[model samples]
Each structure stands twice: as C-alpha cells, then as structure tokens.
Target: MATEAKKSGGIVETIKTVVYALLIAGIFRSLFFQPFWIPSGSMKDTLLIGDFLFVNKMTYGYSYASCPSIRIASLGINIDAKDICGIFDGDNKRLFGSEPERGDVVVFRHPVTGYDFIKRLIGLPGDRVQLKDGVVFINDEPVQLEDAGVFEEAAGPQGPQGLRPRCENGPVGDGGLCVKSRKIETLPGGVSHSILNISEQATDNTGIYTVPEGHFFFLGDNRDNSTDSRVPQAARGVGFVPYENLIGRADRIMFSSAGRSMFAFWTWRSDRYFKAIE
Candidate 1:
C-alpha cells in the first residue's frame, strides 16, 4: 500500500513539473520573444522558406497581437491570440510602443484574417507609395535600385509546404536551376536590402496609394510574388495593416532547414544558423 502511495505521489509531482514548465514557456513567449517560422518565399533571398527566427516582442511593446497564437493540427489544439487576449484589444493602442522604421522586417497579424504575415515596412502612415515599372516610388521619388545579378535555387519542391518557386527563367525541370533577377533596393533614409524580380506583373505598375493615418504599408522583398499592400484585403491581399496589428520585429534567424521536417539533420542549413536578418 505504501509503495502504491509513493508511486501516486511521484506521478503527481511529475505532472506538476510539466504544468509549471508550460506556464513558464507561455509567459516567455508572450512577453519577450516569439518564434516565427518562415513558411513562404515572399521574403525570398532576404528570408527563405524554413528560416526560423524569434520576433522581438519588446521592440514594439505589447498589444493584443503580440500574444502568441498556438495551432497544433495533430493535437487539434487551435488557439488564436484573440481567444486569449481579446479583452485587451479594440483600442488600436499598444503599451509602451515604439514606431517601426521603414525597411524594417516585421511580423504582424492580418487585420481581417488574424493570421500572421511578415513583410518589409515600405510606407509609413500618411506616405504616398506607388510602384511604377517594377520600381518603388515614395512620395513620387523613385527608390534606388541596382542590379545584383541573379538568385538561383533548385527547381524542385522546397520546404515542408512543397511549394515551387516562381522563377524568371522558368520551365525548369526538377533539380534544375530556378533563377530570378536580383537587385539592391535602397529605400529612403539609406536602408538598403535585396529584392527579387521575376517579371513585370500587374502589380508592378499602380496608382499612388495614400496610406491612411495610423496604418502602415508593407511589401515583400520578392516584389512580383507578394500579395501585399498593393492589393486590398478584400482581394485576399494584406492591405494597409493597422498599427495595433504589428506584433514584433524579426532581427535574426535562429535556425533553418530546407527539408520537409526540421528534425531532418541532413537538411539543416548550417550557413543560416544564427544568421542576422537584414
């Protein structure tokens, strides 16, 4: 009887340890840094699919969007940040918030869908932004772009999503080289980054979009492939994201994998480990 009682107490203690660990992890994720996995090529050479980074939550302070959204399909555990922290939402204000600078890579919640999206901040509130012939213009001044050669990757399926990359030199067979034109885009205030181009698309040329006050305009580095501020939310694009929807800034990549599973040691991208995000 005593042996059974000891075993029961041990089990209870183990359960308590697990619960405490979970609570600590939850608090850590909610307040300081949130893990973000790059699932798409929208950011391209700047941030490839399978790049894992921690969003610096404190950079923009706290808001309802800063709360982590947990989704485990296998476990059927789907929890949105709104479900946990919705009580703190609706004001469109952030606590101890700081303004995000242009050219900074950010992760924010989609205003309508509540899903997270990462993009480079291209336009601030009240900025006039436009794209003409695949070039970005801020307040009618064209941004500086210099050809940076071409970016190439395998034509086969990439990452866990098995998504094929759209290439400028397409019609590539599996295991062949998929290529896109690369350029060094220098935004206003001297922030420069790499941008990829496949070809001229409808989004390449657009009328001036006057970003409304209290909202920001963002665009992906992969200009031709992104569905960003150029398209409206109604059209399934991430329209001018609200200030409160901003979650955090992504500073550096923590880990990266090119395979279907992160645990595939052979597929780990050693060069990308602890790499800084530009």
Candidate 2:
C-alpha cells in the first residue's frame, strides 16, 4: 500500500511539471514573438500571401484587443485570463510611449473592420503628403526614384511568376495599369525606402493632407493595387491610422513563399527564409 501511494504521488508531480512548461512556452510565444501569416498581395514583392512572418510583439508593447495599453508585469504571471480573452472580445488601445516613426513598416488593427494590415509609413504628424502623377510627394518635394533593375522571379509549386513590374510612362491617362521601375526615395525626415511605380498617372490621388496629431498616413509598396490612405475613410479604406492602432514595426521577413495557390506548403522557397527586410 505504501509503494502504490508513492507511485501515485510521483505521477501527479510529473503532470504538474509538464503543464507548467507548456504554459511558459505559450506566454513567450504570445508576448515576445508571435507568428503571422500573410493573406493578401497588398504588400506584394515586399510581402506575399503565403509568407510566414514572426512579429516581434515586444517591439511596441502589450496590446490588449481594443482597449488602451497596459503594463505587462512578467512573462509567467497568470493574473488576467479576462485580459487574454479580451484580445478578441473588446476594443484596441495602445500603451503609453508606443509611438511609430516615419518609414517603419507596421502591423496594425485596421480602423474600419478591426482587421490587421501591414503597411509602410509615408506621412507623419503635420506633414503634407500628396500623390501626383503616380509619384509620392512629401512637403511639396517629389520622392526621388532609383532604378534597382528587375527583381528575381519567384517560383512556386504550380509554376513561377515575374517580379512586380515597374511603371515608367507615368500614370496612364485612361486609368489603366502600367508597370515601371522601382526605386528608393527619401522622405522629409531622411527616412528612405523602396517603392513601386505603375505608370505616371495618379488615380486615387489626394491633395495636401496635414496628418493630424496622433494619426499616420500609410501606403502599400504595391502602390497601384493597394487601397490605403488615399481612399476616403467612408470607403472602408484607411484615411489615417491612430497611434493606438499600431501593433509593431515589421523588423524582417522571416520566410516567403510564391504563388497564389491554396497548397502553399509544398511551394515554400527555402532560400527566402530569414531574409532581412530592407
């Protein structure tokens, strides 16, 4: 009888140990490094639909659904199950001191549907941003373009696709798609990054927009195909993203896959893994 009691006690202890280990891992994954999957081509060339990315949660701070930001005490504190559940249940708000900078690629909760999107910052507070003739202008200066030649074609299980074509003829006069060269342009704050041009004609162009305080203007790398701040807020597009909506800056591309096919697993491009985002 004594031996049986000892054996039962040992089994219970082992179970507790396993449970605690899993809890710690889950907390780390959620608060430090969370995995995100790309689901659209809005950020194409820079990001793809089948790409798997690791979003550094600590880059900003603890985001609690839709409520304002809060302090995270430690990694293993099991204090608020309500807060964890609130991620999908409540509103989104940012913690204090969580500000985004110009040229940071950020993932944020879309103001319209509360869905998440990753986009590049173009205009900051009190800056005048406009899109004229398919070129982005900040503070009345045209964004400089540097031709990078053709991007390497990406291959998938189904077949292969060419790089995002460049647009050189300015915006099309008739509102059709045009591909031109890609280039890196410096913003007013000396923040430089690459952008794609599709023809010289501007379609969803906007006039001088003084980005209001506590808001930001974002545009997709795939400028012509993206529905971003250029569209009015009433049209279900982002007019300006509040600081609270920001999740974190996209630090790097963890991995990438090609094609728009459903079976993306077999099409993974092993060479693209861990490529740093430029």
Candidate 3:
C-alpha cells in the first residue's frame, strides 16, 4: 500500500514540474522572443521559406501584439492575440516603444486580417515613398541599387507549401534552373541589403505614398513577388501598418530546413544555422 502511495505522489510531482516548465516557457515566449518561421518566399534570398528565426520582442517594447496567438487545428485550440491581450488593444500606442528604423526587417500584425507579415521597413512616419522602374524611391529620391548577378534556384516546388518560384527567365521546366536578377540596394541611413527582381510588374511603378503619422510603409525584398504596403489593405495588401501593430524585429535566422518537416535531419540547410540577418 505504501509503495502504491509513493508511486502516485511521484507521478503528481512530475506533472507539477511539467506544468511549471510550460508556464515559464510561455511567459518567456510572450515577453522576450517570438519564434517565426518563414512560410513564403517574399523576402527571397534574404529569408528563405524554411528559415526559422526568433523575433526580438524587446526591441520594440510591449504592445497587445506581443501576446502569442496559439492555434492547433488538430487539437481544436484556437486563441488569438487579441483574445489574450484585448484589454491592451487600441489607442495606437505601445508600452515603452521605440520607432523602428528604415531598412529593419520587421514582423508585425496585419492591420486588417490580424495575420503576421514580415517585410523590410521602407518609409517611416511622414515620409514620401514610391517605386519607379523597379527601384524604390524614398522621400522622392531613388535608393542606390547595384547589380549583383543572378539568384538561382531549382524550378521545382519549394518548402512545405510546394510553391514554385517565379523566375526572371521562365517558363522553366520542372528541374530546370530558375533565375532572378539580384541587386544590392542601399537604403537611406547606409543600410544595405540584397533585393531580387523577377520581371516588370505593376508594383514597379507607383504614385507618391505619404506615410501617415504613427504609421509605416514596408516592402518585400522580392520586388515583384510581394504584396506589401504598396497595395491598400482593402485589396488584401498590408498597407500603412500601425505602430502599435508592430510585433518585433527578426535579427538573425536560428535554423533552416529545406524539407517539409524540420525534423528531417538530412534536409537541413547546414549553412544557414545561426546566420545573422543582413
């Protein structure tokens, strides 16, 4: 009888330990860092579809967007950030917030859909932004762009979504090489990064967009492929993201996998582990 009682007590202690550990991890994830997985190729060579990184939440301080949204379809658990931190929503302010710099790679909540979108910050508050001939123009001046050869990848399906790449030289066959023109873009304030050009598209040229006060403009590095601030939110685009919607900045990639599952050890991209985001 005593042995049975001891076994039961030990099981209860183990359960308590696990519960406590999970609670601590949840708090840490909500307050400090939020793990983000690149699910699309909008950022392209800068951030691949399988790249996994931690967004530094502390960099932009706390907001309602800081709360984690947990959704497990199979388990039937759905929780939104607004559900958890709805009390903190509205007023368009963050608790200890600092303005994000232009050219910073940021992940923020979509102003309309509440989905998370990652893009390069382009225009800050009260700045004029536009795109002409595939080059970004900020404050009515074109950003410097230097040719950087071609970015090549397989024409086959990529990542778990099985999405195919859009090539500058396409109708590429299944296993053929897909290519895009690469350029090194130098933003104002001396921040430089790689940008890919697929082909001429409507977003390549735009009317002057004056960023509103307390809002920002963003763009994807994959010039023609991304649906960013250039389009209006009503048309399913992320237009003029609010300051309070900013979640965090993704500074570096922590891990990367080319396969459908991250657990597939052989499919891991060894070169991208712990790579600092440029």
Give one digit per residue, the lDDT tens place, for model 1 in 1-278: 99999999999999999999999999999999999888899999999988889999999889999889998999999999999999989888899999999999999999889989999999999899999999999998999999999999999888888999999996788999999999999999999999999988899999999999889999999999887999999999999998999999999998898998777878889899899988
| Residue-pair clash count for candidate 1 | 0
Query: Tens digits of per-residue lDDT for model 3 on 108-162?
Result: 9999888889999999999999988988888889999999999998898888888
> What global local distance difference test value does model 3 have?
0.93
* Candidate 1 weakest lDDT stretch, 10 residues: 259-268
Candidate 1 lDDT score relative to the true structure: 0.93
Rank all candidate structures by their TM-score, best first, as comma-separated numbers.
1, 3, 2
Task: Output the lDDT of residue 207, model 2.
Answer: 81
**TM-score for all predictions?**
0.98, 0.70, 0.97
Lowest lDDT block of 10, candidate 3 = 259-268
What residue runs in model 2 are displaced by over 4 Å at the alpha carbon? 1-26, 65-93, 151-180, 199-204, 259-266
Error of 1 at 127 (Å): 0.2
By lDDT, highest first, what's the ranking? 1, 3, 2
Return the top candidate by TM-score: 1
What are the lDDT figures for the candidates, one per model? 0.93, 0.66, 0.93
